[model samples]
Target: MKKVKKIIWLIGLIYVFCAMVNGDAVISSITTEAETTPIEDSASYLPDKEGKENKITDPNNMGDSKKEHLDSEISSGHIISQETLNKIYEQNGEKVAYLTFDDGPAPGVTPEILDILNREEIKATFFPIGENVKKYSDITKRIYEEGHDIGNHTYCHIYKEIYSSPESLINSLKKSDEILQAVLGERYHFNVMRFPGGSFGDKLAPFRKAVNEAGYSYIDWNCITGDGEVISAPTDRLIETLKKTSQGKEKLVILMHDSATKATTAEALPDIIQYLKDEGYSFKPLSQIEEGY
Candidate 1:
């Protein structure tokens, strides 16, 4: 009789323990579901208006912000309108060079420049003129295809027309944007730019406030190869000028023109590239964090 009582007690204890474990599991499951529900609800408010307004639509380029508008693309262009300087130094830092060409996508020269760059596996910035761009839309396409950065050099490339007023600068950029869109779909929307004659003249003065407001970064040259100044300049002269101007500066923004019909700049380009390569410089597009004029 005592053995039978003992067996009954053990069976009852086992049932009670099993019920307690099941009850604890139910509480844990309820707690987990309660915690996770609030997180899902909060995520609905995460995306802002800019995310909606500037949502570029291309499956291939859905999140690729390579050539968005000025405000969106400034960070990539490596230009700095607001900041003064950038200091990127490692334990053993190497030299950095930003190769920028202004007033380009010309007939023969721009193509040659592209070919040379493709051959050498070097990428540089081209601040191309809109009117000239219409002539060589293929080169513009190649520029994007080859992983080089293209910036708006203005639609007309006419200094007087573009800098006439604040609205004019904005309109010029818009026009260029429109044309580039036509040629390259929505992908080649390059808002990074170089002002005609750089910031030396305040012809952009009328639009000064608006330019910043519109989020356009105007680039001026710190280093000039003087290929634009000298007519029929030899390759050696151009190379020497580039070397002299690029000296003592880790960040060099070279100003070269490729718009004119009579530009001798093309002949000197290959030598300049070779010389710069020999000097252990890596090329980049004009971004928002560059040193100024």
Candidate 2:
């Protein structure tokens, strides 16, 4: 009888223990479900315009929309604009040269010059007349797209017209700038200027003051390829002029032309580049010109 009683007690204890474990499991499941608050609706992640959740369409792009917006801002063109051209330095006492071509974007000449520059992996600044840029907008676009700097060289490239008065010069510059921005798109802003026949003489006083007041920097070349003086100057003479003028200058800004008639300038470019390289001079664009020179 005692053994029967002991067996009954043991069976009752086992049933009570099993019930307790099952109750604990049920309580745990209920607690987890209450805490989770299922994500079947996206209200937890994205908010709509009225501070409510909206149904998602194309989740991939929308999910990364912020990143895409930032990327577009990064890819926008970086236009340099300042009165004083900032200096760019080369380490270890290296010489720097800026190769600037003026009065260009002429159909055949500009393209050929671009090819030579591309072949040599060099960058140059082009001061295109407004009329020329309007005439050859496509080539002007190419110049900007190829990562070269463009400066205002006046609308007419006419000495009498541009140098007529301060107002005339300023108008010419403003018009030329408009043409370039139109061709190069809205992302670019040019504050660099180069006078038609070099920024000199008493005639330039008022124009210089106007340009300075308008937040622009005017540049004059220290060396020339002689292409400006004579149309289609001999290749040898052009090369010699470059070599002679650039001899003592550690930071040389060379003047050359890319007008349709000056094919010789294009021919002499490779030799000039090679000679500069041999003399341990680095080729740069006028945008890198140092101020107070």
Per-residue alpha-carbon lDDT of candidate 1 for residues 172-218, written as tens digits (9 for 90 to 100): 87788778777777644545666666655555565655766887766
Q: How many pairs collide in each candidate, listed in order?
A: 9, 0
Per-residue error at 274 for model 2, in Å? Answer: 0.4
Q: Could you tell me how far off, in angstroms, the CA of residue 222 lies in candidate 2 after the best superposition?
A: 0.5
Pairs of residues at least 3 apart in sequence or in different chains that clash in candidate 1: 77-286, 77-287, 78-287, 78-288, 78-289, 79-287, 79-288, 79-289, 80-288
lDDT of 2 by residue, 1-293 (tens): 99999999999999999999999999999999978955443233446778776644333445577556544654424334443443432233558888899998797789999999998889998999999999999999888878888888999988888787888889999999888878777757768888888778886788888987776778787888889887688999999999988877777778899998988888888999999999988887765554323
Candidate 2 runs further than 4 Å off: 1-83, 86-92, 290-293
